[model samples]
Target: MAEDNFEAAPGGFIPGPISSGRGGSGSTARTANSNTLLSEQDVALAAPQADAVPPVIQTLRLQAEATTGVTRGSVSGGTTTTTPVVVSLANASTSDRPNADAADGDAYVDFGGLNGNFNAGSGEYLQWSFAVPAAGTYDLAFGYAFFSASATNRPMRLEVNGKIWDRLFDFTNTGANTTYSEAVTRVYLEAGTQTVRLTATGFSGPNLDYLEIRSADPHRIVIQAEDLLPAATNTTATTVNREITLPFLNGKTPAETFRVGAEGDAYLDWGSEANTLDIPVTATVAGTYSVTITYANGGTTGRPLTLTYLDGTAIGTFALAPTTAPTAYPAFYGDLVPAVRPADGSDAGDVPDQSGWEGWTKSTLTVNVTLNAGTTVLRLSGAGGAQHRQVRVRAGGGVQARAGRPIRHHARQSHGGREPVRRRDRPCHRHRRRFRCAHHRGLRGCEPQHPLRGR
Candidate 1:
């Protein structure tokens, strides 16, 4: 689920937004087929609030109904407009623009008084051009339709500023000729004249109702603890042969006996040569980022973990300060139950508090590194016993490192991006899932909370 809630074009919410491509109208009677577009309720529910802090404003929103400085063929009539109209605009060519009618009914009923027509084998498309005031990040929201007998599974390609951003579907045919499905996602943009196009990719292309583009909020990139793939271990087995040293092992508590984050109740291998953890990482954009690593040291002194890039570039080895070090078997309280999936199941919201999360004391260490834009693994070799938490990269303002609470575990994927600035200043978690940036699915802790009431 994306942070931005998708609004149905005119009717109420349509489950999953896809009509069976199998074309089975005979199987069941379609209900409410007359409402082709989203209802007023959906539009109101989907509206993003203006940030009370900074008052976020839309860079551009093009509605097909009225004159908004858009190129139109001005052609009238005909149920389907297959002819391509070439209307030159600021930064795009209307050479492939779709045929349109000013009449309002059926497919055109709620789509701002008019709608662009697309169908199978129609090379035609619809586009709107805008002058980008500045370069940063923006969220592209499309209100569209194509859910009908022929529109099911219609494939459409979204091209922004001449680059194919994605290929999407008009989805399940609603069997209703007038319905439109809406979707919202984030994209990176360089400041300039930008053209956004919804061109036909295959049969029964979708209709374009409206499009909204707004500057994205500042955000961070996080590497979840559990998602890290082990690069190398000190032993094919156990380090320093803790199995053999019965006397030393039996007398002292081992960090492995404790369950932390994802490593529940399993023994953490520790010895001069037994302890080493490595995780693969990649940076999409080259920039200086503040790196923070969280860990729990059961011992009285700080545990030293040497850090280095895959290429052997020393990222500066540092000691994890002693915090919650376990003293005995089952040292920490509470079991490491499965991570709780958030209410939205996207995990793109406030970090949920764990029931028995506080096991051992946890602490953090910080370092700054300007990484090259590509894939590389960071290795951590501890000279003593310690538990590893997740790592994160923060840009612009700083978010305090969470010590005792659980953190969101995002997948191991690198996206080249600069942090997004929030449009409004509201409590983070309140609007936690409100708006997401390019990091939509994979936000800070997967996603940090923020208010986005930009209307």
Candidate 2:
């Protein structure tokens, strides 16, 4: 019931849902595929300048206990302390937690780890102070655990610079109580040290581990479903129930279990057409973009929806096919198979996943649209019943990257000294390549929607 208390700052931004099986630890690294949708002339005209400077992406990781102060609150009686790390991390000393000799050689601040096995009760909080070289919006990731006996959610309120950012924010289960996962959100910060506080909204909250902050990618705009503006009466922001089992790792007796939903256990249930959403997007670079919606449908057929500009100009229409499975664990989670460590112990690049569904199979639908520089609004009207987690708007032009590897946008072969452009959802005469969407047939700068990594 705590989710009913959803709140966001005035004209504010939130985060995606619980991100266990969804992807990496809310990292900015994304998976993209080559798109040959534009002609050679269009490609040459829209390509990035060779001398253009890359945007500086800022990142920081701070241990929870490493904060300037750890205070004990008297509201509900709770305490905080440092405990051994419970989850595997890329930078961790060891991958094994249960069998590890000593806490993975790292310790995390634990809320209520001393006074009780639960989190700090309502009114108790943990605060972190850090300095930023740039003034901009940054994504915040809280590494935590909430494997309660009740299997219920633990809600907390995120405060940035003494102002509430997200009220009643929560996370999905971490598979096991000792295991950990990251819940992400967004906050705009001015240059210099800023204080962030997480206060329990429920009787208690998830255990504290560490907090990671990174400058939001300028080219990729991620809009959380919960952050939709002009909140509709029928729309509800909440989480769903789903079970995830990780791949069978070598030397591990029982494999790890991954939970479903976006990073912060947040999503929007589009109740019906009345629950239409007005989404705000800030594009640093003016151009065409591919808007990918991460969603799930439990029905047997596709869920129809329409995307358009504020003035009612059609951007695209999608009938996302059903992603539900009859089984307890859907094969859709199998998309994460490539992320499993190989037998040779070499890194598999930690590919992010495409599993955002809760119980049902997770899926994505993308539409291409053009925009000018600055902020804009897009309207989304749906037949309803779809669980939308997040929307990612990516720059449309240029040679796209996939799994962090660069690939050619156009085929090697050419015709009449011009690279043949391939239209999405339609087979090309020369290349015979087709993509996913078909609604953007007449739209300029339209391109095929590339699938996410590990899918």
Candidate 3:
């Protein structure tokens, strides 16, 4: 038989021996969750911020004549006889009186809908592309010239990322020799590379001057410890498989830890003396702010630490005071509930209030450190003990990360039951519906001595 090429679809590949509901040589096979969310893998846990600023902005301004970031049609918006030409405001001639930024030789003329009949589907007429610093809503504004001689209720369709913008309006000729940005449209955009397309319709639109894409007022972004991209404790995970992760636990019952996690469902850990955690953080703006490290120290002595190489460069060391209990505190349930036990445990119940767990002698620690825009790290010596759950970074802090966000650190199942079965085995708490490892049932690519797996 000729060999066939096998490939996974955008929805995803569901590998299974079960096949479909039926069986046989000609029987149909089974596929699970066939409706694939192609973009789910790309979605990041947006560190939400308070909508404070009236209209704080990160603007990307593009000059029309600069043809690199744009796609175009055969003609620009104006009269066809005008040659869809590039006008220099320096021209003292009174033909196409350029205004605003245009008055200074910074506008496109005789292009787009010069004759009022724009080719709607051609290259989106004109598009300006720029990278969005972060994902959020933004206002789209433009600088262009308008004149009554070439005007006929000139309607222009503005689009961001191909979607027609509701801010479409007619650039009624403002009697040649004038620029208008009186119309401002708002649209939501995603982070990363994006495009703002302009299409002329219903009439010839104004000659282009410049395109401005400005993000809403600046707000705080929270980088939760739970959202770090999955990986081996020290190395980046390259493939989509069981992450070489440390122990993870979360939730109300059956999985209780007095060490209250960020919000509630994020209780991940790392205590090895020498290991690395590559945290993913997208700071919308570049500025200095107090970064707080949230972790639990169930021990009585301090955990030695060193601050080194954030985002890659080496740095000096800083020590944090040990988080120790003021006095001896007895375990709530006689030390049965891991190092951290619920503050309130009902031993009488079959499951005991796994909802709450804290170390009888444990305490939460918050260390405030200064971090610049990108690149930061925390080094550990593991001298006393190093166990942390989360880290919170913010500037005008008010709200914390909302509870129940997808967690990044995960536990790969172990075939041989050697490690703590309590947190790792609870299937309910580990798998994420959006994106997950198919080998989670029987984790692969893991060594026998993997820190969070086999004994």
Candidate 4:
């Protein structure tokens, strides 16, 4: 089962502002739907506070209904609106549909509804003015729900202080509208009152709960699968942002799975040897760090993979273990034991289904890597078959080596490459032959004469 506490977006937590095509009902019926969106609260909105001599502010939350000012129609002649309708989580029973759950408080703003349960149309918008304590880049997120019948990719335009930040800010399917997910974007705010607005583009926007502002962590960087450099990507790699339905329990019933807990709810399906991902990353600290990758490998065995720097320095080589069995459901769902289906004698709906890609799972593995401070590209290559979501690099104690040995300081070579002047445990390959360096008085290995010459 995917960890219920999993909250990081698949495309790193702060994937700038999103603009994409990813392809949403009524009200009692609208009320029930909104209530359902509340129950599946995937992330905890309560920010953790570190104890200190003085209490420090952890997160600043602005409720949509309380803080937002609504406006409709043309900006020049739009009428000042009243407080938006705030919906509360419904009390549900075992027989009722999922009850609504709120991340911060009890109620959320009904951005997609008006009057009562009636559907809202385009041109309606909600704006909020909040004060920032400091001037810096912060992670901005919306706790929202969108469960509709006709609309899917309900687009919104974000304007900061009347300046358009993103014209097509995408709010992808959060599986069930009742299932609330945090959609994050990065923004630079000066320490003062800043106005932020979200207006529907073509369709009604998602039901919003609140807007959260938090400090960004420079030591950690997350790269979503869709954010992989297109110029550096292989043509064979395919990116998807939708729900997948597959057979379960001997094909008796079909299961619908979304990239739950994923940023943008998307993943990259590895196609072939040509499918390589070049991830752009910025390291705040230059040192050895650990990279935790969220990926799904459905093969029977592990898939071999190699991580390297853009210049071809090997970070590490390892295999990603399979996240699930190849079977569609039940039999293919590994050792999961759930209630049997009363009619078919198969596993009940309690069994976790494969969520994304053909065999996608929200599993993660951490590997150590050495990175230089500043912007750089990390490359992933090897035999294909694993679906990847997010790669999170965090500063900490980890391995520091280019190949399989520790990196040692040495004088710069005439070729501009810094040779590793460390003693080799075993004989070095011809391309990385060992030599006694006179300048450093230590063992050093020279780079291969040709880029493709070394083994």
lDDT of 1 by residue, 35-78 (tens): 12223333222222222122134666676443554443312222
What are the lDDT figures for the candidates, one per model? Answer: 0.38, 0.47, 0.38, 0.47
Off by over 4 Å in 4: 1-57, 67-84, 89-103, 112-120, 149-151, 222-280, 284-308, 313-455
User: Once all C-alphas are superposed, what RMSD does model 1 give against the true structure?
Assistant: 27.4
TM-score top scorer: 2
Span of ten consecutive residues with least summed lDDT in model 4: 23-32
How many clashing pairs per prediction, in order? 40, 8, 28, 15
Q: How far is 43's C-alpha from truth in model 4 (Å)?
A: 38
Tens-digit per-residue lDDT, 1-455, candidate 2: 11111122222342222122212122221111111122323222221112112224556787765635334342342233233223333333443343222222245543443345453334466777788876656667787665666545565656688754544455656766467777766555667888887765433566567777775545666655544422222122222211112322222333322334333334555554333555556555666787766666756777776777766678887676776321112112223343332221333543232232433223334556786545565666655546665566767885244433344245667578876653323343333344333433343343333332122
Q: For residues 261-290, what per-residue lDDT tens digits would candidate 4 score against the true structure?
A: 233434454554443454545564567677
Superposition error at 147 for model 3 (Å): 2.1
- TM-score result, candidate 3: 0.32
Report the lDDT of model 3 for residue 20: 16
Q: In what order do the candidates fall by lDDT, top score first?
A: 2, 4, 1, 3
lDDT, candidate 2, at 66: 60
Model 4: how far residue 107 lies from native, Å = 1.5
